[model samples]
Target: MSGKITQSNNFIYTALALIALLISASLVNVMPEGILEYIIEGFTLLTFGVCILSLRFDKAWTRFMVSIIICWLAATLLYRLFAIEMLDYLILVLMMVFFWGTFRSIARQILFVGDVDTNKVIGSIVLFLLIGLIWSIIYILIIVVSPQAFNGVDGGPWRHNLSQLTYFSFVTLTTLGYGDISPRTPFAQVMVYMEAIAGVFYMAIVVASLVSAGLSQTKNSRE
Candidate 1:
């Protein structure tokens, strides 16, 4: 029982951290350039740390994530201090790695290893958010390489463009191409379509997981 409670708390904390990251990313537009950027980066790192903590079931896995986080943090600080464009790509790549790791961990718990409890249900939502975020990082990377990858985005620091890219990412993930932002390059187009496909299938996958969990619960109750 205590273990279950602890797992529940981890899920709740991770959920809250993800929410805060989303909010901070959304607010990047209104925030001014220099100091606020650092704050956002710090907040992002903190969210990543919380996510790593939520994976405490595996000490080795958690350690690996910490090392990635450390590398990401170092790259971020150097980018900020030196204003290096290359570091932007590095940071985005590191961020993507961490998010992908967390996404897989949460997905396994919710989809395969766990009962259909409230925490598992919330883990599904977290998985959805991770999908959006992971795609956003990919979009950001493409933009950093080819500034004209998308029609609606203007060239600037990735941080300044994060809000717009993130919005576009989720919009694409939900298959709601608002037409305000359109992917031009072949790579970007492919990613957009893939996200759309994932969005369509995500419901099917979650429903299947839930149904399986329900059946297992009924069987256990009978026993």
Candidate 2:
């Protein structure tokens, strides 16, 4: 109710949003399939939990972008757990928003690391964690959703597809295109290609920014 309390709630929500992204990413990609999908679903609990939190949080333009991506990451993970179908175009829109928003936020943080402290530094690690998180969520969604659209036999290796999808998402997200498990459907191909471009641009921009900024800082330190 109070202004200070409101601000505090907002800050906490933003932080929690970042945390959910990291934690879900870990469960989705790093764990095995049997109970792991269920465990991964557990992360969806964070999504509902964060809904009110997301509403409460207020952020800067930069931080706003970061939080938007967080929303997509959380939503996609939830969709993965329950949707059990391939991504529709709307989901792709959300994914692109999440991907671009995350990429920009990371580039800003890495390039302008000023007055950053212990907590903020750990939070900074989310930049890297996020890439895996968002990609894995989408991949899982693809594996799960693609079945309903691409296959009719009610057999799509739900777990195995998810696991492979994780790898494939990162491969495409990173623009690696390993020539294995390529998309057979137009929907998958479109999603993969778009994500691949996003991935490539994100790295190009962020890495360049980091390198330039780091070099500049080094030169200043030497002076």
Candidate 3:
């Protein structure tokens, strides 16, 4: 019974964690520099820890991955304490891997394994957010390498750029293309359009999955 409850609420937990992370990041603009940045970084780490707990599995490999994430998280926090610039890259790479793995797990669950429940439907939304986050990490990585990768963005710590990049990522994903944050580098431009394509395909696939789930439920009722 506890396991069933956990399964049902897993996505809810993950969604809330992601939302907290986003909110904290979005508030960075209002926050003063120096110590506040570290505070935000700490909050980000806390939310990520929650996400890891919520999405963890009993599988051996999953356990191993979780261990690695925990270690990375610890190291990131340590680096942040010491004011290490390298921590920026470390955190971005760690988050990218974590988001990608969570996306895969949720996609397999909702797209392949089961009938769509409310939680599963929410999982689809989580997948969309994960895509934005994954691309945001990519964009940040590019910015790290080339400060001029984006016209409007400065080459700052990934944490400082998190909100803008995340906003740009989702904007590009939805093909809204407000043009406020244009990609300057050729590779960054390529990534922007690719994210747009992915967003379109993701919407179509989600609609199809919902339709299929509805049909399957109806068939089961008839049976």
Candidate No. with top lDDT? 1
Segments in model 3 whose C-alpha atoms lie over 4 Å from true places: 1-5, 58-61
Error of 1 at 88 (Å): 2.1
Give the TM-score ranking, best first.
1, 3, 2
lDDT value for candidate 3?
Answer: 0.82
Structure candidate 3, residue pairs in collision:
none
Which lDDT tens digits does candidate 2 get at residues 1-223?
2334242233344356656644554464466656665554454445424433433332354466556556656665666678734433344456546544544554454445543333334434444445655665565466556654322123254443444555666777767777766766687667778778877776676556556656776788799
Candidate 3: minimum summed lDDT over ten consecutive residues — where?
Answer: 56-65
Question: Which portions of model 1 miss their true places by more than 4 Å?
Answer: 1-5
Against the reference, the lDDT scores of all candidates come to 0.84, 0.52, 0.82
lDDT of 3 at 215: 90
RMSD of each: 2.3, 8.0, 2.4
lDDT, candidate 1, 61-149, per-residue tens: 78888899999989988987898888878988998998898887778778856578887888888888889989988888888789999
Q: Which is superior by lDDT, 1 or 3?
A: 1
TM-scores, all candidates, are: 0.93, 0.49, 0.90
Model 2: residue 82 alpha-carbon error in angstroms: 12
Pairs with steric clashes in candidate 1: none
Once fitted onto the true fold, the runs of candidate 2 whose alpha carbons sit more than 4 angstroms away are: 1-34, 43-107, 112-125, 139-160
